[model samples]
Target: MTGPARGGADPGVAAAFRETMAAVCAPVAVMTGLEGGLPHGTTVSAFASLSMNPPMVLVALDRTSELLALVRRTRRFGLNLLGAGQAGLARRFAAKGGAAKFAGVAWEPHAGVPRIPGSAGFVGCTVAGLAHGGDHLIVLGNVVAAETTGDAPLVYHRRTFGTPAALPEVSG
Candidate 1:
């Protein structure tokens, strides 16, 4: 039998919502770009496939974020799916300030985009359009090139980083 769904209008509903959402696991990724010859990036879980026919993807960035401004002017960016061992790289890019997050981060150029080496996969794309969504900007991209290195991806769940283990096979 299934259990009854549980939800309520508590005073701390927003925090509870966030806590509950944090339990939903997602793959980690670092979105990078070059603005005025300086590298910039941020760790984001808001990346997803938008279309397969045109090979497009979408990433949401805070409207006020510096990275968003750079993407607006540059019109190109790269998405690097972090490997299970690249948590440090994710944290580095997540940090804000004058620190150079690209320092010591292995990368190469792909379709004029900085593709992070050793990632599970990378996609280089040019911005196709931008739309205002609430307090964020949804940037749609047209894929130019992509590559993979056969590494396991890092996952986020329950407000923490983790890797998924293979589950036992099930038979009908």
Candidate 2:
């Protein structure tokens, strides 16, 4: 609703906000966009379903990220929801300034975007619009194609990756 402080938010306020937000668990996903026939991607925790009727999803990316630029240019992208065992892939994509992030990674093309193999789920989307959100760009995508696997979703919580623990069985 209201914007951040005009001049600058207080350091303590920002720290408190970060600390609080860190406790909230979120799904980990790799957002991929094509760049000159090569795949460019980044790990994203700021992603969520936005609508159902038209099948829309939202992902927030750093404003200056190269992957964001590619998505802006191509107007399309892929989102791969990682499985618990895919932490290595997540770390790889999260790294910066690499020769090729896709090197040694398993992926396939989906609607011209690269989708990580073995991910819990993957979706191909066309950018509907972008919104400025502080240092990030909120990308709203219309899901054109998507698929899901049986694998458990990888989750980010307290700045770490994990999978949800199984629930205890009960008999009524």
Candidate 3:
């Protein structure tokens, strides 16, 4: 692949960056928040644990995403970690604004936030801080409540959804 036009950054730099990040495996999640009393969510692979002392987590969202705006306005959100069998759910949220995103989906309000049922886990939090990143905003959340399931987590790599690889059992 070509580097860039001359020494300056090329227009294709953004595409290159996306291509690079696609190779880095990440967990699939559906971030949910309420807007005008309606449940809104989006698929996100940019979730990560930030701090353990106060129990904080971080998620990166596109600057222009409606979900980001909703979270900013509501100051509260839920992170539903998808399980291996929930690829369809992930795709639903990832799709452009659709009425079916929440229709018939199993979710309940917890701490005033919607938590999708049957996920690997869920985290309900309040926005603790925000930072500007190139083309994305970093949202930091202070965990108010969380729960986990025994299901294996959904994974994303190379622009595809998958389940994490299992390790072989070791004899003591």
Off by over 4 Å in 2: 1-7, 169-172
Question: What value does the lDDT take at residue 119 in candidate 2?
Answer: 94
Q: Superposing all C-alpha atoms, what RMSD in Å does each candidate have to the true structure?
A: 5.6, 3.4, 3.0
lDDT score, candidate 1: 0.85
lDDT of each: 0.85, 0.90, 0.90
Candidate 3 Cα misplacement greater than 4 A, ranges: 1-15, 98-100, 169-172
lDDT of 2 by residue, 1-172 (tens): 5455644787678879999999999999999988677888899999999999999999999888888888999999999999999898888999984329888887778888998889999989999999998889999999999999989999999999999998899989
TM-score of 3: 0.88
Mark the regions of model 1 whose C-alpha exceeds 4 Å error after superposition. Answer: 1-11
lDDT of 1 by residue, 1-172 (tens): 4333343345466567788889899889999888666677899998899999899999999888888888888999899999999888878888885228887777777777678878999989999999887668999999998888888889889868888999999999
Positional deviation of 128 in candidate 2, in angstroms?
0.3
RMSD of 2: 3.4
Quick one: best TM-score, which candidate?
2
152 in model 3: Cα distance from truth in Å?
0.4
